[model samples]
Target: MSLPPAFLDELRARVPLAPVVGRRVKLTRAGREWKGCCPFHNEKTPSFYVNDDKGFYHCFGCGAHGDVIRFLTEQEGMGFIDAVKQLAAQAGMEVPSESPEARARAEVADTLQSLAGRAAEWFQAQLRSTAGAEARAYLDRRGVSATMIKDFALGFSPESRTALKTALKDAGEDKLVEAGLLGRSDDGQTYDRFRGRLMFPIRDRRGRVVGFGGRALGDIQPKYLNSADGPLFDKGRLLYNLDRAGPVAHKSGRLVVVEGYMDVIGVAQAGIAELVAPLGTAMTETQLALAWRQVDEPILCFDGDGAGQRAALRACLRALPLLAPGKSLRIATLPPGEDPDDLVKRGGAPAFEVVLDAALPLSEYLWRSETEGQDTATPERRAAVRQRLKAHADAIADPSVRALYAADFNARFDALYFARPERPPRQAFVRGARYVAPLAGASPALRSRGPGARTASGEVTALLAGLLTHPGLADRHGEALAALPMSDPRQAELRDAILSALALSPDLESDALNADLVRRGVGGLADATLKSNRLRFSFTRRDAAADATARDFGMMVDTIAARTRIELELETATARFRSSLEDSDFERQQALLAERVEIDSAMMRLAESLRDD
Candidate 1:
């Protein structure tokens, strides 16, 4: 829903700039404006400047500059609206809906959020009662404190399904359904989905409740039930503790990603506030991108199980490609069979600190742990291990990261061979394939997108992303993103999103753009604008930005051309099938037709979007 511009203006008027920027970046007096090392980029010199008086900022070093809204939006990697909403909330002023249409839509979202909030309160209150004793004991066993429970707003759902159903219905059920706390019967009767469980409200970086994660309090069937996807909660898109960890993440330039809520709560309680967790699923691109916003490096602290190893490997693969100049990742392994929850129980909070210190960089862990002398007596085993590790390295998209792994891997393998009693010839009579074969259905032409688009997209994405990541970016133009046409659906949708957020949250703060995109359903937009968006220069210091507009232009052109080619091929396939209705041929034609339909939809959206002036 779009919001009126006036709301943003009012929001900015309400909150002072000092508290917002001061939290992440250290600001000292510098003439009339405040100065700090640019948080958007690592810098030795303090070049970023902010003037609280006018609410405008500029960076002499990187050329990023904008209003407080832009800074918050850019720095926290939040879109415009989320930044504003976060800031406005801090000011204790509600972002009132603007037009009736916008207001109505906002109301639906707000109602669900409000319901979740009320349900959270009800759960917390019950925990204080006798019914919550076992839940409290469970927490105590896990080492979570009353203050920790209170801070996280932990609650228990009664064994009676209708208990929660009744509480929400009297207050409101439609919103509860919207928030994903309750479900409906086919006839439209509402019922609580999370019964007889301990509730953990999932909050965005700004601390508004988006959804919940529930653990069975006793021997409840299924053992664990979570809030399904709703207007607000997407299980794949959120981390468990983004709200509480963001500030610490930003300041420390690090993130500790554990596997569960109690793990996060335990670490936070133990004194490490910069901890987050993936909810049950493997860590996702959405979760990582959100973490990327707050810190330069992320420490994947999962259990030391094969499953956890697999999860860590998957995360490392996703992260390697993105961990170019500004980003890095470390893997922290717990003792066998112990998780963060267990470690916190056994050694208390300080145990986590010790584990964190022992964490290994990606190359170190993979080479040292996974490839260490696993019965290399067989050539097949050596080759198999090498193949597996090679596959892991190949997933790294960045040129530098891949090179690092290649060098480190070769060295480690060479060392292992020298230590062996018998070794295969260093080189094969015929060498094996150097790279993994492309997956079936992989686009043959995806690699052909022009470099210019990549460069432009990269710059715009980096600058904008940097701004969204660092509050100090509001004061520096080096981190500022060149605005795109607001009418272009892809860009326009984001613009509308940011604008609406501004109207609601005038101050413009976001923990990460990834979260904001999920909130607005534009993760695709965020990724497209960032991945191929490239630059030849260092993002921290560069020559004139490679024309930022070229990326959008190239993207539209590429999309149109690709669509046209597919359309023609599809038409040919369809015509061949129509000419003769042979069963086998007909099936092939249908397949082509289905692919064409998907291609056509994308073309239409792109075409219509480009048509938007």
Candidate 2:
């Protein structure tokens, strides 16, 4: 039985090519495509490739090529119908039977799509006619070039209600109403849904016109209006410009989501092709999924205004439950009272590029949204913030990703709110009676025991050792460990090797990690660091309890990071004091000295705590 073309297309989109082909061929990722040895013909070197983005596989060795359907039929020797049935089942789609009713429904859907296309053409003709002067002038005011207008299929609907109906009269009234071109009132009176408005044709991924979005040229309520849901279009399931943006986003590994049609068009006019927009609504899960399929983290560019910020937060909340490893969003805030169209129009793509460059990852954006402008000065307020952050992190469906997010949020919270030790009263300074240098008179034992005694390199070595003993810590502290400053090339190489191994196999145990590191030529470094007497912390012990090891490892990382910051501050203050010799510089140096002392005491306390455990 013949299936609808739409159903077949949906099947291709739903079932990724990699897994389907991987069942028979061992595919390894090569750029955006997967490479595997051709199952059809055997050779030493691999030449078969499958591209999920294009939903096809090709073998350069034997010149074999086809999509998932063809692969199943040719490789598995399944009949065409059986191959399609298997894919349909895999995609969780019911195969359309070739019954008269189903055929009629399919025919109606096709007719509606065709009518929508013809309606688009009619609107374009109207935009070029004398009745479209207002729409043309509005486009000019928005700095939309003629080329852009044509490229995006920008058009207009005349002010009269019957203009489109009369233009496409042969399509009949019922089909026009069904296609969302005309609205029927309770009294059974039908009228044009869009009048005196700028028109945007919303197309499916196949570039078929599915619906229309209208921006009122004059003073109209609900400045933008989208077609009501119909068989051909569901706004929640579609993103504007997705048909064009998918291939570009896949190629560049960058996808951008804006707020509306003009934003997409404006950004595209600036030479960026990987852009899409929700049809006048907050992004839906399906829409976000579509964007994720194109790129792992699509940038959601929103205006910096309060409404824009709220929209962005809503999108974040919607996305939290759907986030998985490497699948999340980055948010870029436009200048207040500005959008992509405004920014691009005023300063071109370079201006938009700056915003994109400063985009915040999902975790950072969530933290800021929950804490920015809120009072976290008190313990109660801070506890509330923690609870809220935990709740959001808990929404993530993937356990490993959720745990990592929670750990990351905890680290950020400590850094921002709890890192600073309470300052001593100003009276304790005695107006800087005499500024003593930091740690100058400490005993050698105290100096050697303090976090300040270890260079950044030594601390990194100890951190790596702890990680090697407890490779599971990589799930929670991988990002932090990766960010640790390493000056020694050998230490950095070992650090990268450890992280790479963990990434390749997140559940790798200590022995497996050691083996993998050795394979990468850094096993000696790992062994030497572990065997050295320097890392005496309990967390580095093989027999340490999991909870204690994780806690102690976190403390070690925090202490090292704090020491690095204070050392940098001390160096800057010393440089300024040497140059100016001013009392303020001296006072600043002394204050930093106090902070440094406090950090050393904290480190000693941590050592004591770990030893007690």
Number of the top candidate by lDDT?
2
Judging by TM-score against the true structure, name the best candidate: 1
Pairs in clash, predicted candidate 2:
none
Off by over 4 Å in 1: 1-16, 22-31, 35-49, 53-67, 70-80, 87-106, 170-174, 185-189, 320-322, 418-613
Error of 2 at 223 (Å): 0.9
lDDT per residue (tens digit) for residues 295-331 in model 2: 7899999777999889999999999999997899999
Candidate 2 structure, TM-score to reference: 0.58
Q: Return the TM-score for each candidate structure.
A: 0.61, 0.58
CA lDDT scores, all candidates in order: 0.66, 0.81
